[model samples]
Every structure is written in C-alpha cells, then in structure tokens.
Target: MSSIIKILPDHVINKIAAGEVVERPASVVKELIENAIDAGATEVFIDIEKAGTRLIRVTDNGSGMSKEDARTAFLRHATSKISDDADLEAIRTMGFRGEALSSIASVSHVRMLTATPGSSSGVMVEIEAGNVKSLADAGAPRGASFEISHLFYNTPARLKFLKSAATEFSHILAAVSRQAMAHPSIGFRLTHNKKPVLDLPLSMSVKERAFQLYGNEITENVMLFSGGRDNVHIHGLIGRPAYSRADRTYQDFYVNRRAVKNASLTHGLYSAYGDMLMRGRHPVGFIFIDIDPALVDVNVHPAKAEVLFRNQSQIHDLLRDVIREGLRAHGMPVISTPEATG
Candidate 1:
C-alpha cells in the first residue's frame, strides 16, 4: 500500500475553519460586529433579510482598511492584531486570529468596501467560497462595509441545519444586543426585513444604554454596583432581588469589553443572591468585568465567547462579595447562608 497522507486544499481548510467561526447567521453578525469595534467604529448598522439566510450587511464608520490590507484580510492567519507569540500574552483588540474574514468568505458570498478617512476613493473586494472574484477602486464612505449573502450557501449540509427564520433572527438580535451592551458609546441599529427592530443611539453610560434598550422600566428596577481588588474591577447594573426573570435570557456578562459565558460568573452571581433568589428564576442585569488583559485569556475559545481567568477564585469571591454588599447597601434583604457569610 502506498503511503497516502495528502494535505487538504485551501478551500477545504477554509470550510473547516468556517464550521468553527461561522456556525450560523448570527455568528457572522458577531464576527463582523467585533471587527467593526476593533476598527474603532463609533457606529455600526446591521441589516438582515429573511433572517440572514438571504442577506446580512454590516456597515461601520471605523478606521477603514487600505486597498492592500483589504486584499490580505481574506487570507487565513493574516492579521494586524499580533506579530509574534509574545503578543498573545496581552491581547487587546477584538480580532486577532485573522480567521474571521477567510472563514466567513469561504462559506458565503462576501463583498467588502473599505476606505480610510480623507481618501477620495475606496476599494471593493468580491469573494465567493474562498475565491477572490474582484477587487477594484470605488466611490464609498470613510469606513468599512461588509455584505454577506446566502450564508452557508456553499455547504448545503450546514444550510440545511439552520433553524427557522424567526429563530435565527432572534439569535442575530441577541448577538447584536450583547455587543451593544458591551460598548455603550457605539450606536447600533438593527433591521430585519427592512423593519426596525432595535435603534439605539450613542449612549454616554451603561444606564443610558439600558434605557435605550429597555426604557425606564429597567433603569428603575436595577441598581449599580462597583468594586475591585488587585486590578480586577467588577461593575454594572444588578437587578433587585424582586426584579428577576424566569430564565437567564436577560443576564449579560462582559469580560474586558468582550461578551462571554463563564461558569464562575454565574456561580458568583447566584451565590451572592443566596436564598434571596427565587428558585428556577435568574437575575436580570448586566455584569462587566475589567481585568488586566494579561490575567485573562481570550484565545481559548474558538469564537471568543468564553475566557479563562488566571485568578478564578479571586474573581468569583470578589464578584460575590461586591454584589452581596451592594445589595445590602441598597437595603435589600439578602439572606446569606453560612457559606455565603463565611
């Protein structure tokens, strides 16, 4: 038998990567939104049609890319975020892996138009299924715009696995909502089938953003709490014990401006509530954790939806105590258990 170990082609590799990053239409929204944020965008506009199965467009007024940069961005592992292994230790930008564009372009129809400030013209690149079809100068705005259509079109299997349009659209809304909460200063607008769903203008504070998203009802029901120790600060809106939800759908957590899901965070939150929290119900609030980037790992998750804290126990205890004390200060009765009091 002949030794048969053949290297996968670039397209095959790209499709494989797409499976990890572009799991669904919402995943595309998430990657593009993060890119816009990393580019220092102050405003991001998202439009989807037929729940993103037909079209998904994200426009951002951020530092646009150069013609060359635009071309290179679709190449796998081509990144401006990090240069060497040492840079990984202290990652700050939202996009570092450089796999998003290539991964996304590999699975859908992608067209990117980008131009820097003061530029008279912009560059447009059309790519389909990992193949660059066109690149040319065009008249455009001073930012970046990505239009992805027919998500997972090249992979029939993946496309077939997608949920109903309504379900997928909800996920897209949730994705945008998380990013909007993470960055209050950035204005976000979302439309589905050309109907406005969420229109949040630039907010000065998290409270203002909450108001924009949920109105005075949420602002009045939630309290603010902030505390830190040894460079780990935790701060955000915490719902009053009486104002919780039947599910965890309303809870939002961010670590270093990145939306994430961490068990330690959930545990710390529930622990702080102790028996004050009703059974089968979860708190409704936003939690923002600011820690030294070196102390937190962002590269562990494929989509960066989770992080690992070097001092997990310290963070847990700090979050728990801060919430508990804050609740106490607010005059809310917190029935602390022995474990919680200890």
Candidate 2:
C-alpha cells in the first residue's frame, strides 16, 4: 500500500475545530461578545436576523485592533491574550486560545472592521469559507464590529442540526443575558429581525443589573450576600425561599466573570436551601465565585464554559455555607442538617 497519511489543509482543520467552538448561532454570539469584553468594551450591541441563520452582528466600543492584528486574527492559535506557558497560569482574559475567529470564519461569511484609538484609518476584511475575499483600509470609529452571515453555510450537516428560529433566538438571548449579568457595568443592547429585544443601560452593581433584566419582582425577592474562605470569594444575590422558581432557568453561576455550568455549584446551592425550598422548586439567583486563576483551570473546555478547580470539595462546602449563612442572617428559618461536602 502507498503512504496513506496526509496533513490536513488549514481550511479543513478550521472546519473541524469549528465543530467544537461554533455549536450554534448562540455559540458565535458568545465568542464574539467575550472578545469584546476582553477588549475592555464599555458598550456592546448585538443584532440578529432570521435567528442568526441569516445574520449576526456584534459591535463594541472597546480597544480596537491594529490593521496588522486584524489581518492576523483569522489565523488559528494567533492570540494576544497569552504568549507563553507561564502566562497561562494566570489567564484572566475572556479569550486566550485564539481559535474563535478562525473557527467562526471557516464556517460562515465574515466581515470585520476595526480601528484603534490613535489610528488615522481603519481596516476592513471579508472572508468566506476561511478564504480572505478582501482586506482594505477604511474609515471607522475606535472600536470593532463583526458581521457573520449564513452560519454553517459550508457544512450542510451542521446546518441541519440547528433548532427552530424561536428556539435558537432564546439561546442567543440567554448567552447575551449571561454576559450582561456578569459585567453589570457594561451597557448592552440586543435586536432581532429589526425588533428591539433588550436595552440595558450601564448599571453600577449586579443588583441594579438584575432589576434591569428581571424587573422588580425578581430583584425584590433576592438578597445580596458577600463572604469568602480559603481565598475563594463568593458574592452575589441569592433568592429567598418564598420566591422560588419552578426550574433552574433563573439560576446562573460565574467563576471570575466567566459563565459556567457546574454540577457542584448547583448541588451546593440546592443543599444550602435544604428543606426550606418546596419539593420540585428550585432557587433563582446569580452566584459569583472568585478565586486565584492558578487554582482553577479554564482551558479544560474548548468553549471555555467550564473550569476545573484544584479543590472541588472546598468549593462545594464554601458555597453551601455562604448561602446558608446569608439566609439565616436575613431571619429565614434554616433547617440544620448534616453538612454534605461533595
């Protein structure tokens, strides 16, 4: 038999990688918004069309990239967040692996326009199926904007897997809402098919942001808590037992500002409530965990939606105790039960 091994082309490699990063329209929104926040954007605007199958645009007033940097952003593993292994030990930025742009461009049509604060001119680049169609100097404000169209256009298998338009739009809204809650100081707006969906102004604190997003009913029912132990700080709003939700949709967790879905977090929260919450009813609140970056690994997940803690048990116990204490301090009855540390 002849030699059968062959290195995959760059375009092929990117498409394969896109499978992990760009799971759906929401995934594209997530990566782009994180990039905007990492760039220190104070305001972000998202516009969608046909549930993002036709168009998804994200604009931010952040520190824009240079012409050379914008041109290089489409190359896989080309990142400004981290330069060496030592830098990985303390990864704080929202994006570091540098795979998002490349993966997204490979699966859709992309038009990017960016300009830095001191730059006299901006740059515009268009790419289709991982091939650059155009790159030119243009006039733009000091920020970055990306317009992605026809998501999964080159891959029929992925395109067919997408859910209904309403379902997809819900996911996109959830992703944007998570970012909005995580960074309350940043302003965010969303529009779908020329209809306004969300318009959140700058909020000074998480509580204020909650009011803006959920209105007075939820905000009034939740109480703020702040405490930490063993270098793990926990601070955010916790819902009162009287105002419980039917599902976990209202429950949100964040570690160092990155939204995550962890069983340990959910378990600890429910355990904290104990018999105080009725059966089948779940608590609703935002839980923020802050710990040393070196102690938790964010690189474990391709989408960076999860983290591996150095001491999982410690986190579980801390979260349980913090919420328990907060509830008790507020005059809520607490059923003292055996502490369960997972």
lDDT of each: 0.91, 0.94
Candidate 1 lDDT (Cα, 0 to 1) = 0.91
lDDT of 1 at 305: 94
Summarize candidate 1's per-residue lDDT along 152-257 as a digit string, tens digits: 8889999999999999999999999999998999999999999999999999999899888888887899998998888888999999989888888879889999
Q: Indicate which candidate wins on TM-score.
A: 2
Clashes of 1: 0
Residue 325 lDDT (model 1): 84
